[model samples]
Target: MPRIPLKYMLLPLGMALSACDKGLEEINRNPNASESVSPEFLLSSVLINTAYDYQREAYWEEPASAGRYITLVRNEDNDKFDWGPRGWDSYYARLSANREMMEIAGTMNQPEYIAVGKVLEAFNFAYITDLYGDIPYSEALLSKNEGIVHPRYDRQQDIYPALLNTLKEANNELSLLSRTVDATADPMYKGDALKWRKLANSLRLRMLLRISKNYAPAFSVMQEILNEPLKYPVFENNEDNAEIGYPGDIGVNSWPGGPLANAFAEFDKRKPSKEIVDALAERDDPRMEVWIAPVDDPNGGRMYMDDYVGVPNAIPAPYDYNGGSPHISRLSPMFNSNSHPMLKASLMTYTELCFILAEAVQAGRVTVAGKTAESLYYEAIRSSMRYYNVEGVADIRDYYNLPGVQYDGTREQLITQKWIALFLKGPEGWFDHRRTGFPQFTLGPLAASAVIPKRFIFPDTERAYNEKQYQQALVQFGEDRAGTLMWYLK
Candidate 1:
């Protein structure tokens, strides 16, 4: 009787609505809206964006043109070495996502995600420091949490060691076999934790070797990884390569220069550079056919010794060089397609690792049991051939035996082969060129700069928004110019 009286009284008075209003904020919240995103989703997004950016830098006109892999026939700022301050915004965007992923994973106690995040962070940071010399590291991505809007630029020397340490820590954390990763989230290795571990160690090797000339302990750190197979496993074969494939089903996910993403005329403007084309043609490299198309003859006759004709880089009116567009070789038709099996965005590869090891041995930095510099050198070339699907087409040994192709225990030979294998691999060829000066490049007659660029100048955003920090960085580093040598080079 009492319960009925209260319920009936509230219903009549409209006080029953008060009960529904309790926790109304929770109930009124949109179920479709996500207050927080999942770590896996963040990870997946970061990986895709990173891969696409990397592939673009590798295959697109700017970096490729700068690295002498291709020549831009029109709008040739990069070709003329008229590079301004290149931005690191895209890299920081991915790094910001990666930083968030790590934070959420930390709260969730997901060690695997944390480890993967560390690896990615190290990778991105390495590139940033390598390219720009000094960058925000210790205080970076702290605006939301620590309120550091203008993070100090960390020295490249200091950043390199920190990156190497981060990779080491990631490798140790990834050694835990009980932890699981989302297979779908990992575009490069498909949830293979061990492969990620290999990549961490392999990338460590790359970083170590990159700074070996300047960094004293690089060789010893490299030795530790090389000697320990089980603990510090590296890429054993091409299957262990850290590469991602484009779905190519949509404009956003398609290859950078592919038909879906770029116009045919834009693609046509990028012709193979004489530096790379002549190197391949002289060696009778099968990859020449895979990477470049045969030149179309105007008079129904071949223009060069081979049908392939590459344009001179940094030359005046490059569009008219080698007798206009029709006479010059375009990139292979495979590159023009929306997607192809060979069209992968590589983070690192076993071919590169082999070349790294070969260089290490030749330089007497580290030794592999039962392996000589020459053997690894040949293996490096063979792995490259196999990676390109040109292995079975010709006897690899014959190519190896050719003059300038044989192992001579010279750094030039080792790095030159690496440069060839590093085609379309994102700034690696240029990095090696800066490091070793192998496959020597010359400035064209019309080049704007007296010397090849060493590192990119700091972006305008940094100079504008973070003026104080930018000034401080320049005081420590030097004038903000592309020709200024970074710490590693110094």
Candidate 2:
């Protein structure tokens, strides 16, 4: 599969809307996720919309920013640079939407709906809780009709199991599906159920491994995928990438297209950190040109600066990297002029899979008998390079036979590359960095979160609406702010 469509593999890429135009107007007693069922169809709508929603706000935006950040200021968001504001209401809203969608699926007999919904919901929750800490999951949405209006928060440690199980069940249901309504409403896969199944398993692999250091159970899960590659095939190329579609039609396109009225307004939003630049540079990675745009150095040839750190998080005016300084967080070649970080987003990539497996072998988690992890590691390196369609680079196939090769045995070797692999993919890098503390990134003088934030703070909106419950969760993580540590981080 192609690493990315280099297009909007739009999140919620499952269906086309309009069939269920009423939307939750009539929650079916037993809905089928395909066809005209409002609840089922909304699954795609809800999720695909989220990718857009995330781009529009910081909570969703922050996962990537947080993963990449050392320090920075939000020209538009005082809450971001301030390190407070209940963290991200955007995630909360997304989660609430997910819960409602899933609840509808559950009320109905839509097997695929429950299956996929669980995984997508888990995917969303991972970002939320990981960014914030203890959130109202177990007790959330009770006000709809339930008794407890103030549900206590669930710990992040507890949340991981659900993330795993959700994916596991998703894969299982997908494996046995008789047929799904052409997924006419689906945008992600263009109605392809088989592909969604692969994505489900792929996601399971990622989630299990995400909490690997903390969850001893991850060992078996990893082993299962290795044992059954055929049963759980992962995206082999960029084309199979879990991506969101970009409209590119001005406001309807992505955030980078126009002036975002956010805190990063005066500043350009999201640029490649010196971390990304230097890593690719040191490795002689050819994709640097593709990854970053040259600064306006009238000389024509780009100049490398000495900061060793990086420039302001953004500089966006005059319709270019014109306000540019350093690698303004670069845009994918797929993007035209608007470079909004939200213009397009990735859920996972084949490159990331290669990196994870490479690390797994390098770490002795997956033994390839006599073969050292060197090849896998190199394969990962090359596969990642290939993803950007750089002009030239060696392919992974060559590494299998190369001699004098050695596994990047150091943790740094595994993580640094992993971080790079994760760019535009998922915030997995940010989570990984928080868990393992790699790169020991240097922060800019004005960066927010000072260090990469481990979790997103609860939304201040919760304080007003779900105040009591929010406070109770605050106690679980030891802080009310998004930065609080959850079960595993502690």
Candidate 3:
């Protein structure tokens, strides 16, 4: 399998179907080929690679911590300084590549293969739609096949339900199969069908809660999944985190790694925001010390909240901080020695599961007899402690005192902690912030080309090629305010 790059995620539509748009079209061209090749093989190949890109940004917490990045730019006390591509072009490429596998799966009677394909589609679509508002979904990628030149944008409400349904469909289809088939083609799990099934359920839970704001219907399913663990059992620990490990390619590592490592990062890119550092500092959050190191400001270079924050992304630094900054890279144990990010970013974790469970338990959704939100809260914290390898905090008094470390009676308190706990897990923290309006962040402004960025705009290529649908979708989006929320969010 070819290694995926952090800069460009997926293949384009033109490249997706150089020979034929659909699987059957290829067989139609050469009918005599018994088609010894199975759709599962093709799907395993494409899906695993796609997982690589999604996993990359997640591990480094690059874009999600943009909130931190923005703060860093402004010399604020609570953010960091890292930046990655933030637009629809990359996602469009990735989804295009991913959708081809979906088409291949559709032609076969292989339930397992189809289910797995749908699961991947659901995950990819969720990421795309969450990042950019109205995308080409209901009518996308089938121009030559259906002569449908212009596909309309599907409402996000409709998109969300479909994403969940596909996951459910995957679970239903996979459960019917009694035999264990090897899918070594899938480099991530090596074709373990059971893990795929669990992945589907776990992914379903993720999508279900993602729309907690606009849709009240998910509330029911969220409760249902929590109640019926047997029917919808999900990843319960770090072992079950949906991640893809890089095969130690110097240029292939996710963050601060490989050929790009020594050049792409200047050791100044990974500073910890006082907000995050302080929050952890209060708990004496073990991961903080593990992930960051203090800078040597021989001249008291710059300090605040008893800590230091990096300059904004793309801002030229005077020097590279001597390869020592209170950054994740400082925590060498989490990665192999390379200046770039790791490819093995955890998409979700046991800590996230426990946090959700804690929230559910508190809300009376899990049917716990007497579990209070506070109890669930502690469990969430504890799971985070274990997840980050932060052990033996004999004192909770100090943690309970800090502003960030304290648990206020607001939704912000609950989610902010969980968000910080999920570093390097993807832009989920941003997503949660958008959905819940938690933690009281000030979007303000960043570089001349950037803003708080409420949502990503549709790619220019997509508008050029799929003009009809793009024009129609344009009605919902205004010229300015890329950060504006979409219909579902509105």
Highest TM-score model number = 1
Candidate 2: where are CA atoms >4 Å away? Answer: 1-37, 54-60, 69-81, 87-89, 99-109, 255-269, 298-343, 368-372, 391-407, 446-450, 481-483
Report the lDDT tens digits of candidate 3 across residue range 73-99. Answer: 223222322222245555555555556
Rank all candidate structures by their lDDT, best first, as comma-separated numbers: 1, 2, 3
Worst lDDT run of 10 residues, candidate 1, spans: 1-10
Considering TM-score, where higher is better, how would the candidates rank from best to worst?
A: 1, 3, 2
Across residues 1-490, which tens digit of lDDT does each residue of candidate 1 receive?
0001112222322322234554885777566755555677777777777777777887784568767898888887888887798888878878987887888888888878999999999998998888889899999899868999999999989999999999999999899758667987777787889999999999999999999888999999999998998999999999999988877887667777788888998888888889899889778888898999987764543345458888887888887765666678899998888778898888899999999998888888789989999999888888888988898764854787788887788888788888888888878888888888887888799898866788887899997899999999889999998889999898
Model 2, TM vs. native: 0.76
lDDT of 3: 0.57
User: Where in model 1 is the C-alpha error above 4 Å?
Assistant: 1-28, 298-305
Each candidate structure's TM-score, on Cα atoms with residue i matched to residue i, is: 0.93, 0.76, 0.78
Maximum-lDDT candidate: 1
Off by over 4 Å in 3: 1-41, 58-62, 69-89, 102-109, 180-183, 253-267, 297-343, 360-372, 393-409, 442-451, 477-480
Candidate 1, 62: how far from true, in Å? Answer: 3.3
**What would the TM-score be for candidate 1 when compared with the true structure?**
0.93
